[model samples]
Target: MRFDDIDARMRVFETNHDHCVLPGLYIVARIDGRSFTRLTRERHPFEAPYDPRFRDLMLETVQHLMNCGFQAIYAYTQSDEISILFHPNESSFSRKERKFISILAGEASARFSLSLGDVAAFDARISLLPSQNLVIDYFRWRMEDASRNCLNGHCYWSLREEGISAGDATQQLKGMSNPQKHDLIFARGKNFNDLPSWQKRGSGVYWQEVSVSGVNPMTGQEKNTARRSLVTDIELPLGEPYEDLLASILLDGVANRSPILEDVK
Candidate 1:
């Protein structure tokens, strides 16, 4: 057989199962750390529930993903998980689902492991949203989850500090209501409302234009210019305010495109 014929025959196996995301739909890639409980606890002993060092590592990893050639508009990270919103018109890898999943997972795993000086891994998946409303709802869901995680983590750790075993702590909070959890932490003298915003609502990263002042080398003249930069927001709003924030971000990417619900299925 000719070499060309042989090569074509072998390539079918790899390409046969490939699938691409349809255009015009929004893409959100969620990358989550694997076995992070073991990685952050037994193996590394990072501070329980939340740790600045661990959070910084996650933020650095998120920043890297946003700048690493993907058309990511906004990125969020909380508790070893990252969710990135890619521009709707982005055509990278021809919108191949497997390509995004493989490459993003690899990128996040490599960046985080190197930053932490340890071997860690992450998994990636893509969510194809049909409308702007769904996109907002998706982020809202994640933020709500962050709020729950914040309460549960504090309660569990507080119990542990009081000599409660891990199993017992988990059991005690398993059926507890959110109000009860808040009371538990309050009884320990920590108010849920006073916790760091980032801990409760997670953090967001997005691009913004900011003015920069510069000095010209040739004529010693000062000049001010605007540049696009990524801004990380640890203090994020909630409820309708957060929905509005997401709407504005979507507008920046999809201005004058079409009505948000026009293409809904």
Candidate 2:
């Protein structure tokens, strides 16, 4: 067989089932740390439940992903997972599902591992939302989940500090109501409401234009310029307000002007 014929024949196996996200749909990538429980608790001496160091590492990873060659509009991180909302018209890799999954997972894992000075892995899945409302609901879903995780984590760690066995702590919280869990932590002199908002609602990253004041070298005159930059928001709002925020980002003129999905395959 000719070289070109052989190359084409072999490429089919790799590309045969390649799936691309449909046009006009919203693409969100949910990337999660793999086996992070062992990685954080057993291997590393990270503080229990939540650690500022770990949180900073996660924030850096999110910031990296936002700028890593994709038109990511927003990103949310809580616990060991990060969810990214892409611009509706993103055309990277022809919007191929596998490409997004593999590259995002690889990038997150590599970035996080390098930052932590240890090997850590992450897996990613793409969610194809058909409407803007669904995109809002998707992030709302994650925010609520972060609330639950935050409550549960505080409760668990409080019990553990009192020398409760891991199995016993798990059993104790198994069927407890949210109010009951809050009471459990409150009894230990910690108010659930007083915990950091970032721990409860997760953090978000988005692009914003800021006015930068600079001196012009040629004219030696002060000037104000608009520059686009990423804003890491640890104090995210909740419920309807959060939904409104996502809607605003989606409706931003810059987001609307992003590149449309191209026919690259």
Candidate 3:
């Protein structure tokens, strides 16, 4: 049979679920060679925190996950490892949990090994929650971890090296304005270009539209208006390596707990 024919059969079997596929949370773990850090530190010393080149590489990896049919994926980088959050009901990898994890890990490992001259690996786990409250709590825990470890993060260290003060640095945190802490965590250390393409222009959360008439014809129709997502301008703690901070969060602390699966098929 042809490739398309085989794919059709596979989809039929994959989605032939007898029960409802409940919505829940998933934890994606991505690991890469330590050599990447050494190389990056050498190449771009100043812009290390929000380096576009590095962010682009990670973005490509996240895009790979998206293309595989995952939705609502939020990716954050702490040096080589990337953590992604995926919405429930995404079964791009044949609806087999193990297959999905392996596919992501394999793709990330190969891509990083080829592009950065270092070996990489990936692993993932899913935690099903009965309610949205649990999801909120989980994210709140991560944000608190970020806040507690901010001083030791790579971006923070870089700022200190440049003579920035601790107080001033704290004020620069992107999304910590309110006294009441929330569950959602901000993706810190991203620069202007790191944002979705539409968010690059203007300042302070605004919307813009492209007029199709004046734009390049080959680029497609231009009567499109897009609203940029709100992004925080938080900075990391000074004088700490990014990798170490990530390890503290993922490996040493609460993230190490057993995966919580609640009624997800």
Candidate 4:
């Protein structure tokens, strides 16, 4: 076969199933570490349940994505997973799902691997939410998941400290209710409520606009320019309060002339 003919035939397989997200819908790309158990255990032995050191690495990855010339509005990270919210009008790479997934996963993998000083991999999936309410609920869903994980982690670690094997600790938490787990953790004299909010709610990253005073060297006059930057939110609210905050950010992201979710370049 001719070189051009062979090239065209092979390219079809790559693009045959390519799908693009619809316009006017919120785009959330979730990236999760692959085989993190073996990875962490074999090379990076991080603290069980939660670790700020690991959290900061993920935060660096999230910040890179937000500033990577995408119209990302918000980013949330918990455990070894990250969720990035993009504005409805995002048209990068023609909204191709595979492009977003591959690049994001690659970006996260690179960022994490660099921080950990070892190879790490992340896979990504995109979620398209049609309505504002659904978008709000989507974040709340992740937040609630973090809460449940926090409770279970505390219970399991408490048992492990008591000399229970990892398998036994897992089984114990599996049969316990939320209240039971809370009680079990409290019995260790470690109040789950006293834990850091980031441990329970995960961490959030969003763009903030600030005003900076600048003096024009040529004009000799002071001028104020609006600056955009990323802010890490650890003490995020839960339940309805979180919904309200997300709603405000969502509205602002899609609003006309809004500063959030703009191209960094």
Candidate 5:
């Protein structure tokens, strides 16, 4: 065998036996909302496949969590559900996982409601997992769900337009499995590259500020102020996958009050 393969096998073997170093708190957040589907259908009635706006909003929500003090916050979307990851040592928000989930859902719902002129709601569930394997399984389940939903029909159609078919896409995804589950989370280097350049650069989030001009909900009067805000671009550990970095930051935030660092050891 090649030296690299042998080394990789050795590392895997060591990781499999090491119990202490792998223990860290993991938060698996599932975000859901009916509004997303409704808005997607309404906005892209003829698209018959995907809505770029929906995807943009979801990414924005993920970015919001990352900026709000979550370390290693990585988000992946399938259907209307967004799976988010966080590392254990970071502590930028109190009730970190729950708060971010709630905030993300609320922001998505508000944006959709306001932009579409319809009522909407989003909800999320945060859970702690014991092992990285479980996290991997969770992502696999979501990916399978996305495939079953016709290759994330709402998201895949866009990929298909670019020549990626549903069946081939699903198989390609399955081939790129990761025990760490970080592979499953969306990253700027991977999935982000598939997006339009404007989105990759986060123009949609910024444009929301310029496009929205109306009465302020809280003030109940006409307002010229920008309502939408962009989350700061967080710097991640060098060479780390975006999802892993996001997870680290989020876990740090959650670990502030709870002593869960040992779990990731």
Candidate 6:
């Protein structure tokens, strides 16, 4: 009946469900906006398929996550979702799965809400990739998903513009082949291939070292400095090239990075 005894009894249930990601594996945390279909279409009404304003909001969330002491090597965002790849050796939060899921979801939701000037919620789940091949395949999959979504979106909106109801548009594209979708949109004067790469392949964010030279007023001397900053890739490659690109990043990301130095003249 004592307080300590009751606490011990409850603690058993709490620790029983604890799960941690195994070390020496790459961690990918994908956060998706919850009920964002309704939020975007019904409430906010953003441009279908893609929106610059919405993309910027998602990028801001990805930037915040990369800098949140998570040691994320790369981040990708598209269509109300963001996926971040963390370095293999990062041991944050003791590699607790729940910690990664809850914290990332909370951080993404908060950052996106701030940028949107309204409430936005996200749910996150971690995937432990065992090898570089899997990591490359994972991103390749997302990029392909982006392409599929982009095609479907443009087609649906095109039909809607022609006064086709949402349900009918969905039904129209339901059995359409890839080439058929392209032809359908092309007939309507839109080229799927000419659309922005970001729309088709999603956007990527990675760190790059920039060299800057500045003169000191007091010393009258020049100094070279290096700093690491996030670079957004709006025009990402597709197909095998995209996979090879991600494979290279996953293979030599930190090894090839230059040391950031700041020595004032």
What C-alpha lDDT values do all the predictions have? 0.88, 0.89, 0.43, 0.85, 0.49, 0.84
Per-residue alpha-carbon lDDT of model 1 for 100-163, expressed as tens digits? 9999999999999999999999999989999989999999999999999999999999999999
Tell me how candidate 3 scores on lDDT.
0.43
Error of 4 at 8 (Å): 3.3
**lDDT for position 3 in model 4:** 98
Best by lDDT: 2
Q: Which stretches of candidate 1 lie over 4 Å from their true place?
A: 255-265
User: Could you tell me the TM-score of candidate 3?
Assistant: 0.43
Lowest lDDT sum, 10 consecutive residues, model 5, at 200-209
lDDT of 5: 0.49
* Better model by lDDT: candidate 3 vs candidate 4: 4
User: TM-score, each model?
Assistant: 0.94, 0.95, 0.43, 0.91, 0.44, 0.91
Error of 1 at 178 (Å): 0.9
Q: Rank the candidates by TM-score, best first.
A: 2, 1, 4, 6, 5, 3
Report the error of model 3 at residue 140, Å.
3.3
The residue-level lDDT of candidate 6 at 158 comes to 92
Candidate 2 wrongly placed segments (more than 4 Å): 253-265
Per-residue CA lDDT of candidate 4, range 61-163, in tens?
A: 8888887777888889888889999988989999999999999999889988898888899999999999999988888899889988888878887888889
Candidate 3 C-alpha lDDT tens digits along 1-265: 9999999989988667633334344444333434455556764342534455665565455545433444423444433444454444444553455555566677776776566555545555444555444544444444444444432344455455568796765555545533212211223443322433211211111111222234447976555433222121123222234333333333322322322211110
Clash counts for the predictions, in order: 0, 0, 9, 0, 31, 0
The reply for model 4, stretches above 4 Å from the true place, is 1-4, 219-223, 256-265
RMSD of each: 5.5, 4.4, 14.8, 2.6, 17.5, 3.4
